[model samples]
Target: MFAPIRWLILALQFATILPTPSVRTATERDIRCSVVWFPVIGMLLGVLLWVFQSFFVHHMPSLAASVVSLSIYTLATGALHLDGLMDTADAMGSRRPREAALEIMKDSRVGAMGVVVCLFAILGKWSAIASISPDHWEPFVVVPMMSRLGMIWSMVVAPSARSQGLGALFARKIPRWTVAVATCLCGAVCGLVLPFQQCLWVLLYAILTVTLFTGWMVHRFGGTTGDTYGALNEIMEWVGWYVFLCASA
Candidate 1:
């Protein structure tokens, strides 16, 4: 649990605007902990986001919450995941060979396809969250947890599309067994935190979404990359929220 902290703190500084301690040199163990603990931070962010938004529910509309959520999300990681999401769309747009796809992803400029995809992702997520009433607070909380957990799970299991990339860095060190532990822990947390019936549905949806993403990744880009993981995070959050809330309804 403590192992990821040193590495995580450094990563977090890049992804979020947190008041972190001075950037310290990290060991491989620290890197391992980064992969493990980074997702946990996402979970914590879920809870904090919900609490913050919920506190203002009476004073603000759903759109306001969405804006706040989006703001917090962008500010949290400085849109690190979102950048990955865009890079992935550009790669997919190419529909070229694996090397071409990877090369296209590396280009700093965002392409037209990438722009539309990212806009859709943000608006899709915002609309989904914005439409929900405060009555579905649990789903809001669970959705973020599931999405982030799914990202972590993908990192553990999915092969990196390129030999040299951020996904490769994390995926390289992730033990195969870590996937099972993280999946179970995510389920256990949801079970303990969510309404009983909703718990089952949410976990199932998360697992299903994770599986579907794995398939899409392997089939389309040949394997996983940081961009795919980010897109997966956004997609699965919507899936989890939709299913969990619908089940509750």
Candidate 2:
């Protein structure tokens, strides 16, 4: 087995745009093995956001802090999930035959639907973050973790929409054992950072959101794709934010 730190580095390297230890010769198996560390990446991201919030929340208005925080979020991950969201939106909005819709998603150019989705997603998250009370900031840490867990769940439950690409690698290579272990780890992390009731609720929400979205992807394109996986992560974050909002309310 790859050392735990190696796996974690790989996960961090893949999930974020941050500089990390080189793995120039990393194989598909190495990447597959890294799947288990995905939640750790999320937790790392949450902690960074938490620290950013600490600095910003004390100095700036909530709305400004929220915008800056969201910008940090985009930079940290290179807006990888947001790109997925946009591509998926473009594909879904095409309303063409399955192949044609997939073609639209594969195109490098963003479509009108993609623009609309990105606009609203950013606006919605900014609004939610700004509105949330500081006392409930713990949910901020848990939300990112839940969203990464959502990505794993999507890979576990859905076939790849295409024969090649990141989605296929994950769908085919990630074992059921990894998913099981990851779930336990995520549960542990959530339990540590959130109330038992809220942790359970977010867990349920992540599962249902991933399952439902993957099912829709299957119905539309015969399976999931890298783009859809990204979309799933983005949507799950939104779900987390809204759930946190409602819970805090």
Candidate 3:
């Protein structure tokens, strides 16, 4: 059900743009495609990075290069996931009931715990990209794609932890087919950019890890909330780096 693949990108951006409002505007059928469009966004961002890397990471020393690259790549999204990661971390710190955790997540206040997790996740991505051999641009182009897929994984496996929330609408409307298609599309992109062995390994590890992690969250939370989904995306991508570390072109 690649219905309106073109609109998939629009729907994805729409979720970020109109957010909760989009659910009211679009039919339920459009919901899953919204999540599916994430990798496409990542792919577009990756292409931009691929195009500009020489002007940034290539010319700079490794540490400086990583910082420059992360800034360019993440600033495009205004560090959206980073914000989610931070909020999720703060929420996790609540150590209370689900309602309390979500309340903390929604608070505008940024706590030290949130900042620490955000900083570490950001630095981890930078370090992974920095340590990667300069000749391998595949990881550069593909990791973002995989990272977005991680978001979808959270949406797919976990039920909404709460009723009448963002995660609930997403979980209610998103289709299983969209997940399958997104996975295949992601596989195709990775195949184009990576050798068979490397692509297979990274994908296998990513899929297994995401699946297991999503399952754990589902069991623990009895479903997923918006914050948990955000947390899942950040965690999965950080793990993706270590998984890919074993693979090569």
Put down candidate 2 lDDT per residue, 19-69, tens digits, no spaces.
Answer: 988865777777787888887788788777767766788899988988888
Candidate 3 deviant stretches above 4 angstroms:
1-6, 12-25
lDDT of model 2 at residue 122?
A: 91
Q: Ranking under TM-score, best-scoring first?
A: 2, 1, 3
Writing each residue's lDDT as its tens digit, candidate 3 over 117-145 gives 98899888777767776576677667768
lDDT of 2: 0.85
lDDT of 1 by residue, 57-131 (tens): 677887887788667766676777778878888988988987888888888889998999889888877776676
Cα distance off (Å), candidate 3, residue 158: 1.3
Q: In terms of TM-score, how similar is model 3 to the real structure? A: 0.84
Best candidate according to lDDT? 2
Question: Which residue pairs collide, candidate 3?
Answer: 161-224
From the highest lDDT down, the ranking of the candidates is 2, 1, 3
What value does the lDDT take at residue 68 in candidate 3?
A: 78
lDDT of each: 0.72, 0.85, 0.71
Screening candidate 2 with a backbone cut-off below 3 angstroms (N, C-alpha, C), the clashing residue pairs are 161-224
